[model samples]
Target: MSSNSNSNSGRRRPALLVLDLINEIVHPDGKYAADGYFAQARDRSVLERTAEAIARARAADIPVIYVVVGFSADYTEWPAGSPVFEKARADGRLKLGTWATQVHDALAPEPGEPVVAKHRISPFHGTNLELLLRTREIDTLLLTGVSTELVVLTTAQAGHDLDFRVQVLEDATLAGDAEIHAAALKVLSRIATVTTVEGALPSTG
Candidate 1:
């Protein structure tokens, strides 16, 4: 828990981190994806809703940050012998300077918006995200992104450990599988505020 105590502490608005909205689609085989379902698993609806959430956060004067996964062309920066590195080595996806590394058009960040590149499941692990958040004096976070069981879960755990108030936008994130998505949300709902996109909209105040 945060030691912060002040009348305005709880009311300070939360920043928004839209995670992994990049074009790097994973597990296209569907066999390796969640629930083994193809149609909804590949749909971009969740990304779109996350984009709307970012917009709302911006309108509320909250900072909006994006975290994406991408590696240098040769991926020499990936930890030696990592499974993700091995998979990318074979697939050759998310190469920097390639179209696949670009954030999706519908949810791309505008000029001057920060897009932090990460190689691990937790965006803040080796990135400047935590420093940036601290510099901005943000005490809460409105988390939304893909792979609820992966990136989203790792981030929430980190946020809780760092003493930031975290809220997982239920309808604004998706996993590769429906069951995986549901289970992740259930686990996260206990440790953080779990809310629907509409219910968590920025207040007009």
Candidate 2:
């Protein structure tokens, strides 16, 4: 966890970033469930915790941004030689217009919440996420998502570089296994505040 006193200070303008909670990655019936993300997510109660985080953000009047990874029907934006996304291309998963790319129902975005689509691990890459944050004056980020080693970590590093204070809600995220999740959180602790939803956003009195 980051020791900086201001890491979770209440005064900082914050936005909740829900990353890759789409069906293809975390849903039980999704194509990528065979990779163990679904099991880990279920075992860790990631969806439940993430729901709580989202609700808290909403109650606190914080902007909530959803980032989903998907490709067009023809996949013109798909990265051709990348190891991470190769399986997705091969399996024809993560199609933008399909159920596979939709956000999980448990944590669905409300009527007007922005759902930004990206073709890469980092939400900031080739997406208007940064512009949204800048326009909203969001200087802090509360991250909650699936596959801790991938999107969560990538976004934390990129957000830090972009000078936004980043906090990863540990209980609201997981990897393919406990060890991988822990290791990723350990690495993220140095650059971002690794905290639980409660720790980052206490309930109102």
Candidate 3:
């Protein structure tokens, strides 16, 4: 279906989902960073692009939501010895008061935008992201963030399953696995609209 067709079919309000673009945490740099085909040096440009997208979304008056990873005082939610997280814990990473847990200041949401704490790949998985979006009467979600194949793709899949009108800003999302990112784009295009950051703009009134 066309983008408008999918959106207008049932969507009520527009919102933005900004995944974990916080700090330098990513699949390409931690315990999972060098695993198999995911191995690649983190791309600085991708992070900058995501920052740019966030700025644009805010300018458009689209409600923005941010997701970040942080652990409780005792790290209860983190599975003991899980390779993806254990290494970080051992290295003293993403602790509640640490720098890695903070959203990069350049792209931080404003006073009223919601911030969801996450423990896994999908921010919507263990967080109240869905409830916040619903409370805002938002039916359309524009996804923007780092590592497209991981957080972006996972959250997008979850959003699709939840029956939200999904639109991924192609330039706004990135990934360590080029193939995985490409595959995600193709599959998501089948289910949601894909547009460039420049293509989506603040509506002049």
Scored by lDDT, the top model is 2
Could you give candidate 3's per-residue lDDT for residues 1-205 as a string of tens digits? Answer: 3345556667446787777766645444433345432232244355456666667667777788888877876677777867556766666666666666667666766888788888877888777888887777777788877566777777778888887777888766766666766887887787778886666544343
* Backbone steric clashes in candidate 1, count: 1
lDDT of 1 by residue, 153-176 (tens): 999999988988889998788876
Per-candidate TM vs. native? 0.86, 0.94, 0.78
lDDT of 2 by residue, 38-80 (tens): 9998888999999999999999899999999999999999999
- TM-score attained by model 3: 0.78
Q: CA RMSD for every model?
A: 3.3, 3.3, 4.6
lDDT of the candidates, in the order given: 0.74, 0.91, 0.69
lDDT of 2 at 38: 95
Candidate 3 Cα outliers beyond 4 Å, as residue runs:
1-12, 26-44, 81-83, 202-205
lDDT of 3: 0.69
Candidate 2: residue 43 lDDT (0-100): 86
Superposition error at 134 for model 2 (Å) = 0.6
lDDT of candidate 3 at residue 70, scale 0 to 100: 72
